[model samples]
Target: MKSILKVKNLTMNFGGLRALHNLNISINKKEIAALIGPNGAGKTTFFNCITGIYKPSNGDILISPKGNNEKINGLKPNIITKKGLARTFQNIRLFTSMTALENIMVGCHCVTKAGVIGAILNNKSTKAEERLIIEKSYFILKELGLEIYVNELVTSLPYGAQKRLEIARALATEPFLLLLDEPAAGLNPQETNELDELILKIREQNDISILLIEHDMKLVMSLSDNIHVVDYGKKIGEGTPKEIRNNPAVIKAYLGEEVV
Candidate 1:
C-alpha cells in the first residue's frame, strides 16, 4: 500500500521542553490509523506540526497526494490544506456566527480559484465558482447528514451535530487525507457509535485516508487498521489493533490491560 502522508523523525520543542522526540508515523492510502496515548503524550502536538499550526523543530513532513513526495514542513496552514490535507480540532472550532452552510463555504477558500480581482469584478468565472462552492458545500452537508442544519447557526446545533459539522467543513476542503483530533471526545455512546459509522462512510465514499487521535478504546479498536501508541512524546508501539492490544508496553502505558 502506498502512503499518503509520512512524518520522519519528527520533533517539536518549546523552550526547554520537547513535545515530540523523533516520532515517526505513516498513513497508507485509504487506511484508518489511530494515535493513542495518555494526555500530554504529544498526540495533538503531532497533529499541530503536520497541519502547520506549529513548525517542527526537526524532521520532514512529506505528503504524497499523487505518488510524488513533497516536503511540506514550514508551509502555511492554508498551503497544507491546498496540498490535500485537512484537519479538525479536538475542541470544536466552528464559525459561531455563520450558518452551517457558510462555515463549509469558508473551507472552500483553499480550493477555489477566484482571486481578489475576480471577486471584485464579479466576472462570469467568479460567479460560477461561487455557485459551485455553494452546491458542493450543501452536498457535503447532506453527505454528513447535516442538510437540516444547513441554515442554522453552528452555535445553535447540539454537541454531536457540531462535531459532525466540523468534519463536514473539513470535507468541504476536499482533502485526500483527513486528520481528526480526538473526534469522539465529549460524545455519548450512541454518538460515538454514529461517529464510528460516519468515519467509515467517509473513507469508503470519498476514498480518503484518515488519521485520528482518540481515547475511546472501542472506537479506536474497531475503526483503525493501524494503531500507534505514544507515551511521553515518544512512540511505544505500532501495529494492528490485535497486536497493539497484546503489546506489553501498550498495556503498561495506555490500555492498562489486554483488551477483551
Candidate 2:
C-alpha cells in the first residue's frame, strides 16, 4: 500500500462501552488529513489509539516505516514516537520553568543514543552529539520564528508563541508524521492565519504528513487535503473538503437541515 498510516478494523473499548468500532482509515505519505467531529465523538479516543496511548483490543495500526511497513499498534507511546511519530497536545504541555531551548533539548532525548554516563562525563562521542543536538535545536527554533524566545523561559512567552514552541518541540523529535490537536485553539485571526501558512509551509517544504484534530472549520477546510467527519463516536462521512461540505449527513450532524 502507498499509505503511510493504515488503520484497519481497529476497535477500542472502555469496559462495556465501545469508543471506536472497526475503524478503517489510511493516510498516504505527505498527505494532510483532518478529523473533524462534534464533541464526545471519540475523536480524541481515536487519536489516543493511533498514537499508542491506548492499545486496541483487536486489529492493526500500521505505519510505513521511514519507508517500510511497521506494525506499531502494540508499542508504547514513547516507543512509537521513537519509530518516527510525534504529536502535540490539545492542552499546552511545555515545561514552564525551562527556557524554550531547554524544552526542545529535552525532546531530543529520544534520538540521543548516548548513555547518561557518556552525557555526564563529557565523553568525546557524547560531546560531539551535544554540539549537533544543540545546533538542531537552534535551527528548529529559528524555523518556528522562536529564536528570540529561545533563551527566555517558556512561561514568559506570549500564548501564541507558546503554542508555536510546543509545536517546535514536537518537530524537534524529528518525526515523519505529526499529530496536531487543535493547534489554533487560542489564536486570534492573525495568529490563526500565520499558523495556517506555517502548516502549509511545513507540508510543502518539509514533506511532513499531518493528521489534525481541529474544531476550527475554516482551518480544517482550508488546510486539509482530505477530511473525515465523525459524530456520536462513529464516522458519518469521509471525503475531500468540498465533498464533505456538501455531505448531507455531515451537515445535519453539525447544522440541522431537514433531509428531503
In terms of TM-score, which candidate is strongest? 1
Instruction: Tell me each candidate's TM-score.
Output: 0.96, 0.95
What C-alpha lDDT values do all the predictions have?
0.94, 0.88
**Residue pairs with backbone overlap in model 2:** 65-68
lDDT tens digits by residue: candidate 1, 112-230: 88998998999999999999999999999999998998899999999999999999999989999999999999999999999999999999999999999999999999999999999
The TM-score of candidate 2 is 0.95
Residues 115-151, candidate 2: write the lDDT tens digits: 9799689888999999988999998899889999979
Q: How far in Å is the alpha carbon of 75 misplaced in model 2? A: 0.9
Which candidate's lDDT is highest?
A: 1
Once all C-alphas are superposed, what RMSD does model 1 give against the true structure? 1.8
Candidate 1 wrong stretches, greater than 4 Å: 255-260
Q: Write down the lDDT that model 1 would get.
A: 0.94
